[model samples]
Target: MPISTYQVKSFAFVVREGSISGAARRLGVSQSAVSQHISNLEATMGAQVLIRGRDGVALTPVGQDLFQLADEYASLDQRIEERLRGHAALDRGHLTIIANAPQPALSLIARYADGYPNVSIDFTLFDWSSAMQRLQERRVDIAVITEPAASRELYIRPITQSRYVCYARRDDDFAQRPVVHLRDVADRTLILPEPGSLTQRVVSKALADHGVVPRRLVTMTSFPVMKEAILEGVGVGLFLSASSVSERSLCEVAVPELDQVFTTCAVVPKHKLGLRVIKSFLDVLADSRA
Candidate 1:
């Protein structure tokens, strides 16, 4: 027998979440039920889909192949639902956005909702890793991410550039420093997003290139949290450079010879542009400020 769509969904969620418990929470199902579905899927496919351990679950090579298939299956399912709706329903519709919370993407979503108030919109925020999971699962239409999308499998496109700027408290003497080096911030505490976050990863690499890693690191989920901490004298750190005064109060310090550039992206399946709604959002994104 062929594996069912639900089983595929269960499998993909399990793989992305890295544990049966996490998958169950996402799917709104019980852990045993998720495991049973995966078991049936693996049996029907004649492959050991998942390797279970104390660390959690990981997909076998064969399971990875199915993961791609599962993504396609989800895309098709969504397209079918959209197509089945009437003309009027099509004209006024709902769009689900999944991306890093508190970024300009949220601003895009807010503007879209304001313009099309009658058309319902659901915005889902996820950290970089979970956003990838949502995009692959077709749970979201597009992801506005800070991470570069280059896997080819995920269809990464760079819509625009968002630079990384160093900022500190207004009265902090560090801001007065002429040229900031990783050496300067070496012993200072740093406010940053989690390791899985794209911005943090890029900064981490930049630090590694300079042979400097801070001993004190604070990890949070969003920029606002990190920014708040920075302003509160918790730590001095770098964040995405934007034109907003509220987001940028301190000065943009020049780091000592490193690639501090970040690209804000609209990530989706290659064929996602087939829909007018998806394409329209992308167009809006391109026209908007950096």
Candidate 2:
């Protein structure tokens, strides 16, 4: 008899998650059950597919060969189930999405919920690395990420491009200007996003290129905190245009040297393209673009 497809699926999840417990959580099955599936698969193949170690499970050379095949089988099974439910009115299925920036994702979510009232969305706010990790682990069905590093496992669709701008409280002197340069704020305190963020990368590079340095720098990890700091007359801060365009009390100033336009993309597992829920969200995204 051939190895069971269910067993293959369990094995695939283990490969993706790097631990049996993680795979069990993803499949909503017992740890013993997952272990049993792997044992059965190994017995059927007459090979030890996984080598358990202190760090986590590692695929044996044989296991590596089977991994891709198992993933393809799982993808085909998902597609078949989705097709069987064909045109079921987009009334069910929950989407797990991870996003780095909230603006475009929030906009997309609002519109998607409005059109498909029955579909549920679970959104997680994460940094770019965390978001990419979730996608690679198959924990999230979709990801809205900014400046994602190149990867072959993900299918990326460019959604939006955002430019950096400066925002300051209305009473601040820089608020009177239509544009702000890094050199102009050398003496003033500058509020900026935390290190390693896309916004920070763009802003820092521009300042370096122009050889301008701020006298004081306040680094914030959260956008709301940065915004609040700016609102309270803390300091002028760099922000993406999408985030600052609607601010009532903050003046927007263009940063010409920081002209880097960051592109945010919708990312999904390469094999999950045909899933109904993924298709539904992408449809909403495309419609929004139109």
Candidate 3:
């Protein structure tokens, strides 16, 4: 028996979309049809290619090897189809983008949209960990992340560099200070993002290293919420600089111990770089740097 291209493409879409239903929607087929294609693929290969879980499908070792080639084939097929369609190549497409912070990602997205107005974009903000997870899972087209881990599978373009800062109400005592050390916030309430977030990991390490413990530690869902909590007298909030909206009632105080600068980068899978949509967005990024 020979392997079918439809089966491979279906498997690729399943991995790309992270769910059977999503692949079905992308393929304009029924869920049962997608599952049948996957089952057929496994039978032909004599191995299980996917591990279906409640969250989504994960690639087995064999599936991982197959996906790399299938993804490239899919990209090539799309390119060929676009070429045959003439000027419609760059006129339409969809991109899924994830980011940890707003600045560079939102700005870059705006610029890309101007050049490719017909292209639809789905942009979402996530904490550092979640953003990177989505990128690793091959679920998103692009990721703008802070200090993204190096991987041969990904191509990273440095966007900007920034350090962490503490946010406090204008009337708070720390707000009037030019700079505060890690130990300075020890006796005050501390507001931070929830666990599993980069902010929490970095702050936690810093606190442990310096043996600084806050009087009360509070966790918020996001940077914007942390800012609001600060205004409502919840506690001092810590996060990367320029990550949230600036407010007249809030003051950004520099923290010397947490002054390590982190680079933000736009990352895409190496194999995805050849895709027209991905390549176009990178062109926008390149133009911005020039």
- Put the candidates in TM-score order, highest first: 3, 2, 1
Candidate 2 segments whose C-alpha is farther than 4 A from its true place: 1-3, 11-71, 132-139, 149-153
Error of 1 at 233 (Å): 1.3
* Candidate 3 lDDT, 15-52, residue by residue in tens: 98889998897778999999999999999899999999
Cα lDDT, all candidates? 0.71, 0.82, 0.87
Instruction: Please write out the lDDT profile of model 2 over residues 57-172, one tens digit for every residue.
Output: 98899998898788777778867876888756886666778787677888999999998898777787776666776676565678888877778988899998888888888888
Q: Report the C-alpha displacement of residue 189, candidate 1, in angstroms.
A: 1.5
Q: Using lDDT as the measure, what is the rank order of every candidate, best first? A: 3, 2, 1
Residue pairs whose backbone atoms clash in candidate 2: none
Choose 1 or 3, whichever is better by TM-score.
3
Question: Lowest summed lDDT over 10 consecutive residues: which window, candidate 2?
Answer: 239-248
Q: List TM-score per model, in order.
A: 0.67, 0.77, 0.87
Instruction: Give the alpha carbon lDDT tens digit for every residue of 229-269 in model 1.
Output: 87788888766666224534555566655445667787876
Native-vs-model 2 lDDT?
A: 0.82
Which candidate leads the pack in TM-score?
3
